[model samples]
Target: MRITENLIFSTVLQLLEERPVSKITVTDIVRRCQINRNTFYYHFAGMEDLVQHLLQAKTKEFLGLKRRFRRPVTFLFYMMLVASKYKTVVLNLYHSDMRGALEATIESICHHYTHLYMASLQKMNLSDTDRELLIRYWKTIASGIFLDWLKHDMEYDMPHAIKRICFLMAGNKDLSSFDQLKN
Candidate 1:
């Protein structure tokens, strides 16, 4: 059963690379997978369900990264690298009606990594409200950067951009200034 589901997932991704999500249909997926319509329906309700499941599975795979990154920016860079591997599929999805699913996946990944980064900085001693705000802030920045890359058709070197961001962030001597603002 899981194998069939994976086959369907792969088929959709391959199809996505060739064309936009709106242009693909259940008939196309099942035909490409060499599976019957009943088999496809058994695993997924429809195209939207399949796309959601595929994105969720990708998010799980991303969250399973065991290597500890030194900083949140490094983790974000790794996430971009992973996404870049599916450049065509991502671009196709971004330009398609199913863009919401792609954006949701990006947001989920950013939120998880931002929260993880915040938890690792135990010495910061941030209040719960402050911590939540910081998480939201960083997540938005990460998500926006990624979406902007997609918007530009991904022509730029992402690693170089990330390194510049890291350098800029590291140069900020008053990192704890935010704490002073609340006083």
Candidate 2:
């Protein structure tokens, strides 16, 4: 069942590379996968569901890879690497109405890592609201950078961009105040 599902997914990705998602249908996916509509329906309800599942699978893959990195910097490095690898697919989804789902998944990932990074900073003391605010703050920054990169067709070097972000954060002395989130 998983293999069949993967086949459908891979087919969708391949088709996506060649055409817009709005034009891809379950019939197209099934025909390419060499499976009948029943098989595709068995795994996913429809194109939208398949797309959602694919995005989720990608997010899980990213999260799994990120777990190996203890530092937020390295986590971000891997994150950008994954994004760069899937730049085209990401851009496709970003431009589509499915953008909300992709953005939500990215925000969830950013929130998770931001929480980890804040917790790792033993000196930092943040209230519940402050922590939420910080998470939202970083999520916006990370999502904005990624979206901007996607909007520009990823013309820039992502790794360098990540390094630049790290440099800015390290050099911003005033940002230290963020270590202690006030009311």
Candidate 3:
């Protein structure tokens, strides 16, 4: 699909605020876009497909956050803000009674970090044990963050709270490969 698919998806999400996805048919999307039904189907199979595509794209954007480890940075705050930006959509995805789309999104983000940690280990000259330790730590940290965001009304700023919580995640690891995280 062309870049306009992105615009169309964004519009769909905006429209979702006014109505649920199930009720918003492809014809509605075409009408809103001033395009044809073929154009809508050309981009997505249906509203469900459109929702998945938008969630994946938006998650990519959300995870591009920079968490401060060298200095005190509000990783948690920024993270929460990003999540809250899609508050309605996320809540709907979780509670819409369709499937586990919301849970899938959160789990995907968690696993993404595991891969990130493993890749960093591959690039570092650390011992196998140290690398494994970091990976385990990160997995736990990611899970905790996910649960924390879901609970507590998800009102806390993740990045801001991360400044204080980063210490809890701190370790006596060798920073010889700090460039990995920094980059």
Candidate 4:
């Protein structure tokens, strides 16, 4: 991200903590960053464009976190950690008309991580349809839980909650197992 873009991004996120995205204008962002409207326009086409860029940028950061952990569950834990870290901005997006941006980001993260998980299961033989269904299933489950946490003001122990849910899912014999995971 360019310096000006980063400045505008941070400004928008900070402003989001105080107001909804729909209510925030490019002028407000430039004014907060102490820059002119033209600068904001130069960096972003408009407020919606800025919001989408921010979402994709942040999603990349979370996906990058997957490289540090070998286990899919650990990668997921990091995802929750980030959500908790940015609770204020997340809640702001949730209540705003741009909620889909947040949801799309979550789905993208889950989808990428699920592909990694499936790749790790070398002996698992799932059809293309099943694989797609599986990815969507995990994506929905993960995103649903994360959104639930956001909706409830993030009062729960997210890491522990995710761990328990994983344990429960893994413990179900009929749900298919990852026991064939490559060492």
Task: List candidate 2 stretches off by more than 4 Å.
Answer: 66-73, 165-183
Q: Rank the candidates by lDDT, best first.
A: 1, 4, 2, 3
The lDDT of each candidate is: 0.84, 0.74, 0.63, 0.75
Best by TM-score: 1
What TM-score, computed on C-alpha atoms, does each candidate reach?
Answer: 0.88, 0.80, 0.64, 0.81
Comparison by TM-score, 2 against 3, better one: 2
lDDT of 3: 0.63
What TM-score does structure 4 among the candidates reach? 0.81
Clashes of 4: 0
lDDT of 3 by residue, 1-183 (tens): 666797688788877776666667788888888888887888888888887888788778766753333211223344456667777665555556533676677656655656554664554687878766766655566657766667655666666566554444454255434423432
Segments in model 3 whose C-alpha atoms lie over 4 Å from true places: 63-74, 97-99, 114-137, 151-183
The segments of candidate 1 whose C-alpha lies over 4 angstroms from its true place after superposition are 169-183
- Clashing residue pairs in candidate 1, if any? none
Q: What lDDT tens digits, residue by residue, belong to model 4 across residues 46-108?
A: 888899999988877766664744555676677777777787788888888788887888778
